[model samples]
Target: MEDIIDKRMVDQSEMSYTVDILNKGVGQVAKKLLEESSELAFASVEQKSTADIVHEAADLIFHFLIMLKATGLTLNDVSEELESRHKN
Candidate 1:
């Protein structure tokens, strides 16, 4: 006996999907940065290896750029914040 499968019965849209919920023009970059930071936190709790953490950190930085793009900010803004903190 042979079994039959129906592909047409599947609803593609019902499947899980990921979407960036941030606004397209201004908040996207910041949203991505926040997402990356969350991932880093998760990785730390999960006890991921050092190499993995490093890679995740890199990803976080890249996402930060996206966030800056979204928020109309720049690396200089972040740098200035860091500088002020160092003085304290």
Candidate 2:
């Protein structure tokens, strides 16, 4: 049986980060996201190990999702945007 409950667990983690970031204010969340993004890009450009790059990318995405949630946006908004662009 395919377990469909994984999304909820992932969302709970995201929600916890969102709440923590929002408590510190949007600026903190934005700063963290920028840091994560820079690290990910740097790792990719520098030809880092695959595992290292993957770790950095995950941090970037987690922070990005926090920023999105802090700004009252959901992952669905991004998905919809990408989907719309695909249709175009």
TM-score of each: 0.56, 0.75
With candidate 2 superimposed using the best TM-score fit, by how many Å does residue 4's alpha carbon deviate from the native? 14
lDDT of 1 at 72: 52
Write model 1 residue lDDT over 4-88, tens digit each, in one string.
0112113333331111322344455555667789889888899999988898898887566555544556677988999999999
Give the whole-model CA lDDT for all candidates, comma-separated.
0.58, 0.75
- Estimate candidate 1's alpha-carbon lDDT, on a 0 to 1 scale: 0.58
Off by over 4 Å in 1: 1-23, 27-31, 85-88
Error (Å) of candidate 2 at residue 37 is 0.5
Give the clashing pairs for model 2: none
Model 1, residue 67: what's the lDDT? 52
Q: Tell how far residue 51 is off in model 2, in angstroms.
A: 0.8
Put down candidate 2 lDDT per residue, 1-88, tens digits, no spaces: 0121234334666565445566787899889988999999999999999999999998888777767766777778989999999898
